[model samples]
Target: MLTLPGYLVHIRKRGGYRKRFGTRFGRGMDIPVKRAGARRIWIQAVSLGEMLAIEPLLKALASDERIEIYLTVTTSTGYALALEKYSELAVGISYFPIDFYPFSSRVWDRIEPDIAICAETELWPEHTHQAVKRGIPFLLVNGRLSDRSFKRAMKLRGFFRTVLLNTAQVYACSELDRDRYVALGAPSERVVTTGNIKVDVAIEPVLDPVTCSSMRAEMGISDGFLLLGSSTWPGEEEMLIDAFRAVREHDDRARLMIVPRHAERRHEIEAMLRERASDLAFHFKSRGLPERELDILIADTHGELRALTQLADLAFIGKSLPPHTEGQTPVECGVLGKAMVFGSGMSNFRSIREGLLQYGAAREVSDEAEAIATILDLSQDPAKRGKMGEGGKAWHASCKGAVERTVKGVLSWLDR
Candidate 1:
């Protein structure tokens, strides 16, 4: 009953809706029959970010011969990425069943996993309760609560307490996260600080310099200082475009790249580009490469941020500016050794932000004007940028090993 409205609204939308419609009702899931004598572990990642963050953990578990993996995602893009990236590693990849009534139970019965894991803050009551009822240990990996989420959870304190009670363990991203879980009624003994797996994802660059140079050439960006807007949300794009214009006035070689959080928002961003920065030559990744040289590139695609961030001289972590709280992950930028800037709303990654600032890897701005000024200043300072990049690499190195800790803990629990 609670999910009916969301279900109806989801189905009414376009793009992979019909294909995912059945999964919500615990039907049409592509989970394979469990292998005999194998320990099947069911892992649920809510979307693309969660899916990417959990990749290392997935690989670690897959290394064990006795373990079989069943991975489920709650978004179309996440399912698509799973098929593209983890089809071989994961025994089966499908949409997570709706976390309500028979839907959750039906899926649970079908998989009959020895252990159930939810990534980050995706602790659905019905899902956790289903695992508890079946005596299956439920785990929350890389768990965190943003400032906004903590406040909301306190409002529904009773409800969250019941959910936490069912969870066997929570692998938090930081000490603060551990405290937040404990305050919300999660048993302190069950909550452990495991750092963040996102650090693992950004430990090294996947693309080589030659490949990065070729990619830039393909985008018609030749030797220009690239300013990337990583995982931008609404309003961030406009601010970036304005900053880019200002940046270009100072440095003619400055290039802009905007990768919005949702690829579906491509058209919206395109329209905005036409309105705000009509004078600049821009190209969209969704469309083929431009015939002429381009000054701006819009990456309106999925699973390409890592590749794009590698090409950036300076990057902006989006969703941190005004009107949007709970910022996007800056771990990738920091780990990739890029000088970065973000707005004040980094409560989602509060610990990481503090670390990055402390290490001189990133700069935090108060608003759009300050962000623009900071970007402008950083654009011309090669030595400062280099130092910042080194700082980012240092900070990222210090934050590594969460995946290893999480894998060891999970396997030990399963053995017990």
Candidate 2:
């Protein structure tokens, strides 16, 4: 089969092959010794987004004296973030074992968690089988089946149903997600809509006016409206650059900021920016604050999206443009109360997208031209942008409490 080649491609794409090779293949893991009388929990978050989503849940679980947590992440970036954010909270943090025979089994034997939680769609067969054989309650938290994934699951309905059968509960993010999980053979009685926990995670503290002004000054902006490209993917940087060019033609006060999804793509983005907008002065955040006034700021860094979003006047959700299908999370923009836009490729967050649209919190553009025009219009009308921002903030508030409900469900299962 293509498993080895697929894993090789996966490992190579993220770089750091040698360091990740042993642990990923189930050779060595730093699982901590279990504390006497303490129930150990193993939580797997696939990447940065999933790791961020589980922050509130981790805090809630940590508050209980009887429980200990071991967290695992797949990507190098996620592992780094785990170390940075959860070093004190979690007992151990390591790379997730590759899902196969001895690999998944070895890690499972080491952790021997009383309970296991998998975020989003990480339903690894070998991993699930290990927990099932051990009689551990396997839970699917903040679960969703995106449009693309739903289609694929439908094609492999039988196999997927087998996996679903192994899960003790499916804590779905929306009624639609609950229905989708049931349709895919998750027992209807075991699946429940628990709202979106991303809404429950803490938002960045609001900056004071003086601090905001100083940060703006540091970025070389003196009264310009910022157009932000949040978590952009391939082909999106070029589209945003072209759109920024168009916006600058109408309003010279308009500036641009791009925080690409993968910081490793910095050189590619830098080359595109230089070629497309030679007249514009841009600075990379990795190089520290700009020494002079600049027209653009390229944020090629990690774990700073919410902080950067606080400075934007308008935001465009990335990976929604042409040649790309799934869209990035708009939760940060919604929570930060920023006026935003996205294309038609948001099937991944279909439930959240619909909620944002219904609340008048966002704009859906058909193409780059529409996105440019909308940005210009919103930039010119501060009152309209303000209303959309307030609407987004309110919508985010309405979706809170998922983390509380999830904690209750998880702990109840652990007790039983």
Candidate 3:
């Protein structure tokens, strides 16, 4: 029952994949258990942030000789990092097959997974529906439903409701989120709250110099700057720079470093500060741009952020700015235990944002004016900075079991 459009997209993806033999299609690509005999478990975490949550699950699953994990992602940056970070965990990392009826059917028919773990909310009707038809248990792990996501689901209420009946269980990230899922047609009895698996992504703050050095040196940043902001977005930078300048107005010794969210915006970001902050510097890791000398250092690159965030004393995760591309709140900052600040546009990250605020792990600013005020206060107050970092770290440690709990629930569901 393949639609023409689905068929065409499948053929296109297959052909595109075929064109790049070992480059992308090489055996090193992900190998999930889609076959009857395949002991593989397919775990789909879309990118670096998701990969952070997935890493711990992968590790916990590693102790099981019977379990083979097929980790899948779309972005090249994700593919490389998964290979670099979790090389030894399970099977392989590769492109997910296009989700057409026949293609997904073919993928499912081959891998024949006994049970599947759909992390976060990547619920493709075609994929889950096929799993349903085949009697494979589909487990939703670390799930959450924003009010915004909930409203959208109500539109597709019946469709998602069908998706729910096929799912054995879902370990939602929050109680309110669980309620949202049930309201959107997830089976109320099957959905359980297990908090966020993001907490498990926090490692013991390795503070390893070799990995940190390799990454930082490559990004043209040294120990001098405070590495205040990790991944900044557009309008936020002007606000942040203003805040940093305000910080300078109080403490001139403070050096700041930032990484923009998009690589393409590097030139514009450089240009944005040229007239006023002419001493600003730009380094591109992709094009072999050498680490150079300048005041405002921009790590305009990719694949190094996980390690690069280590150098931050106080990290401002971008994408929390107004009209953002919908920011991610830099959950990785919590892993680094750095003093964090974000804008009030954190409606999307409500639970985590409030959690951080309660733990005194972070401060949320409402706008550019407030941003300046907060930064200036923290700049002159080293004690506040240290306190925030300590509080964030403690809270981070207390929430480390998310991955373990999630992985176990998935296996239990599939086993059922």
Candidate 4:
């Protein structure tokens, strides 16, 4: 079954499959066995975003000489990022085993973790069962239960509650999340509201002034107003393009830089742009310097959004624009103090959105027309833009210390 075309393609593309699969059968392969008297910690994050959220915790844990860390990720991108970012700190990085009784038991035996931490919403019943049966502590850190997810979980409350009860504790991201988790079968006493770790994201801009200026020049926007559409999703790109067109109708010097959430969709996005409006000249960041006459810069590359956000005069976070999707994190824009706009579907980051609104840090638009109007208004009024930017910086600063609080909470559990 693993040799089928689609499965084979996935495994080959991800690489190191044999070694990773070996770990599922209690074989460590090249991974060093844990020291006899050392504490072993297994941390699992489901994807890139979850991995990013757990960075502060990882760094803190790495500093402790008595602890050994083993990190696992479910997705190919996440596994790649783990190796790139944490190879030195971690004992080993591997793909998470399939969450079946046999596979989970094999991995449990191999790692023999003193504790297991799952970032965000990555809950596997078999894994939890194995941990519970082995008497190893299992914790769900930075946990959240969105309304949509809560509704679905409620339908299987009996089973889900049993699985959740196996966890030693659940550190929820918000009070609402705590309540929802309780309603869905987690013991109220075992859950605590630790706030969202994402709010404490480290925002060190990768580009300095010289490099930023060079990048701007290369993208044909050294002197113009740059509006970044950061981490935009599929349908959100079209809405942004339309908004950019409207903005350019009045200010031709304005430029739109879109960094799509998925870089692999660059070709699809390019095709869509051509189909929607072929007259709009755009260049892909991966292809080299853009033409001097180009109006749009498609940052179709990975790990560049942070630097790009720093360059923008204003930004619009994606995923929110489409009614069905719950929006990407705007915390990066907030942290950078950028004047920003986002669509109505921001339930995933509801607390962050509300905080930004209370401080006048961001504007929420219900549709494309509203987004265009707000973007144009921000572009024209320097004073308004400056105020929004400052407000965002203040809001983001106020939201710090979640990481410290979360680390403290995790340590309490580990100590016990």
Best by lDDT: 1
How much is the lDDT of residue 52 in candidate 3? 64
Candidate 1 residue runs with Cα over 4 Å from true position: 10-15, 202-205
The lowest-lDDT stretch of 10 consecutive residues in candidate 4 is 22-31
**What is the model-wide C-alpha lDDT for candidate 3?**
0.69
For model 2, how does the per-residue alpha-carbon lDDT over 124-195 read when each residue is reduced to its tens digit?
Answer: 888889889999999999999888999999999899899999998999988988999999998999999888
Question: 1 or 2: which has the higher TM-score?
Answer: 1
Model 1 TM: 0.97
- Candidate 1 per-residue lDDT, tens place, 340-360, comes to 999999999999999999999
Off by over 4 Å in 3: 1-38, 208-227, 287-291
Better of 1 and 4 by TM-score: 1
Each prediction's Cα lDDT score?
0.90, 0.88, 0.69, 0.83
Candidate 3 versus the native: TM-score? 0.85
How many residue pairs of model 3 clash at the backbone? 11
Best candidate, TM-score: 1
Clashing pairs in 1: none
**Deviation (Å) of 159 in candidate 2:** 1.0
Q: TM-score for every candidate vs. truth?
A: 0.97, 0.96, 0.85, 0.92
Model 2 regions more than 4 Å off: none
Per-residue lDDT for 300-323 in model 4, tens only? 876667778988999998888856
Candidate 4 residue pairs that clash: none
